[model samples]
Target: MPLQKTLLALEALDSAYVNGESVKQLFGAYPRVTVDVMTVQGEKGSTDFVKVVVPGSEGKRSGGQAPTMGIVGRLGGIGARPSRIGLVSDADGAVAAIAAALKLADMQTKGDTMKGDVIVTTHICPDAPTLPHEPVDFMDSPVDILQMNEHEVLPEMEAILSIDTTKGNRVINHKGIAISPTVKEGYILRVSEDLLRIMEMTTGQLPVTFPVTMQDITPYGNDLYHINSILQPAVATHAPVVGVAVTAQSAVPGCGTGASHEVDIASAVRFAVETAKEFTAGICSFYNESEYDRILGLYGSMRVLQTAGAQTTPAV
Candidate 1:
């Protein structure tokens, strides 16, 4: 199962200097996947964006026109070093995403490749800064939000699954995983039945879902509250985006240590891997295209929500 991949990813990411080079070295055994590392520097420090592509048998790379599914491990940082030690709760997203990539790559090596390509993107930064929040602290990124979206959200991605560690909130009280509704352009559509079925089959429990407000769907730098950066990728692309949240029964600080449950992380990884397989095979759909077209024709566009609006004046 995904337990092996989960452990491998956790061990690899538990280091202080776990950069892209280390990831590249770890995935060297899988020759079917292509790993690329791009280092970007910000005001605080530098973080490496690690992108691993597991090519499908009849995917677009071979001119087969199969849609590509993107799995982005959305997180502030893997570790909040200099402030906190070891792996933080925010690292769950990175770990799960990496584990999914590893499992898919290994499957390819065993002649079980998917029908379309899977692009997995996440960053590696051990010593990231921590920001204060209402209930608890969050692991802030070394770079800004724009830089994060630019690197993680690729244009080739037809649909994106933005997985993040969402235990730092009190809204969702599940102890395993949760999914969000399909967010496209500026509309938050209904949750896909296909995804719900996959989640049930993987976890053998009722599916859990989290709420997304208008403010949450909007981009960062808007001076608004977001549960986390899980849906931030929606601001940069036209593709439908859904958030896969790793949750807890209680609100755990993102900077808290020893909060990541390996079993839950593995469950999320399994869900992602299965979704990647089904989505690319044309057996799953994120949203109804005809309904979306009708909505667009009737109500016009909500694209303005994707940007930061005009600066408001201070109240007298």
Candidate 2:
């Protein structure tokens, strides 16, 4: 199957699950595992080519004493240019699909062996800006704008984990990740200190200063928009994981865009389960001794499951 078709199938499968349909009912006609690639037009400049118009003429002048003239001036084009790329599948097909999309989006990847387990981490710097430029007392720079990108790494990590958590919820928790309440419409999710701390602990990477290039004007008067751009990939990644964590700022535009981001938590959880099943099947195809042994060890401990249950159980 083509990658686009595979993605469409996965998306359809997700939709079916959301609509209260079973996985068998949705994917019964499709092959068990498939790999495909999709190309998306990424960021592009204005598409509308400049059209020159003459200064004096609004309409065609017939038999004019002078020369033919119809207001001539440079005007911005009608459409915007976009980025394009090929994406590959990684682990399970769904994971592959999710990973492919993230990779296409230019997200960064890092992995390390921790306690003999390979922990893969993906990161992306999201653009977010605070409006009205609140001043930091005693600061010389634009404090609000400065703070916006100062913790870029943190939000990127959150987005990565949010994707991971959402995917995990689909497989394990059977719940959709909740959006953080701090975000509002038009504004993208911002990195918080807590998220940064988590990433530092997980990857054992030293804290680096955030870059300055990512700052941008807030789209709406009060809210930012770059975080919203990542919603699709975030949800896509979460589709295969057990659970996802989303900040309140990630906005899902209306249905007109042909993309759906607003998903019911319960339905998202179910989709994650089905997605996990597909992922497991894909992973099984290329299994190795180490991978098998690790998976076995991970699942072998009933104590772990029980402990997890206990941890999540509400206190009586």
Candidate 3:
């Protein structure tokens, strides 16, 4: 089960001094897995961007043609530092991502390799800023959204699963996990059937989905309200992006301490690992390419939404 790894990741990350190198120790035993960590400085602060790659037998690293799947732990920070102690609610995203990578690495060591490469990217920051929001506060990142996309979203990724703590809003009230509709090139596509099937099998219940608005898919700093940063990756890549939300029944502030639930985080990790397995094996698809093409043919590209539009004049 994913519980062991999930708990292990929680312990590893729920600290006042956790860094990338400390996290790298978890994968040291696995020879096949590669972990890269970089310290990037931002105006507000600095954080470590950690990338873990569990390569498949036929992945591009070995000159194979199978597609690459990306898992992005989308979060502002694992902890709010001086303002807050220990891991906060927003840390669920990073914990889930790290746990998934650890589980995949372990599976590979046991001779269970994938058909395509799986790249997991997330930042490590014990201290991050918090932002004021409607229902609750949000954990602001050390870097802006653009830098996050540049570091986490890669071209090699044909599809992406963005995992984030979406509990700071009243939009969705599920207590475990939820998925979003497929979003690509600024268009909010339909819920992916393949993903739904996987979620049902994993959760043993009806698949839970959250709403995605035009503003949510648009880049941050657009002077608009966003449910959360869960789908912000959609603004950065042409690849189809889906959000795997670790949620709550009530609005929990992203910066709230002692709000992280290990069981819920483990569930998200399980879904992420399963999706990575099936997606890389070519058994799952994110969207219907032909249908997307047909819609694009009728309506022009919505890519303009990916950028900050021209400012309208202030009302008199």
Report every candidate's CA lDDT. Answer: 0.92, 0.22, 0.94
TM-score, model 1 to reference: 0.98
lDDT (Cα, 0-100) at 55 in candidate 2: 15
Question: If the candidates were sorted by their lDDT against the true structure, best first, what order would they fall in?
Answer: 3, 1, 2
Model 1 stretches with alpha carbons more than 4 Å out = 314-316
- Model 3 lDDT per residue over 185-224, tens place: 9899999999999999988989999998999998899899
Task: Pick the winner on TM-score between candidates 2 and 3.
Answer: 3
Candidate 1 lDDT, 169-226, residue by residue in tens: 8899899999999999999999999999999999999999999999998988888999
Considering summed lDDT, which 10 consecutive residues are worst modelled in model 1?
305-314
Instruction: Write down the RMSD of all candidates, one decimal each.
Output: 1.2, 25.2, 1.0
What lDDT score is found at residue 304 in candidate 3? 89
Give the residue spans of candidate 2 off by over 4 A: 1-85, 88-191, 209-217, 220-316
Q: Could you tell me how far off, in angstroms, the CA of residue 263 lies in candidate 2 after the best superposition? A: 29
The local distance difference test score of model 3 is 0.94
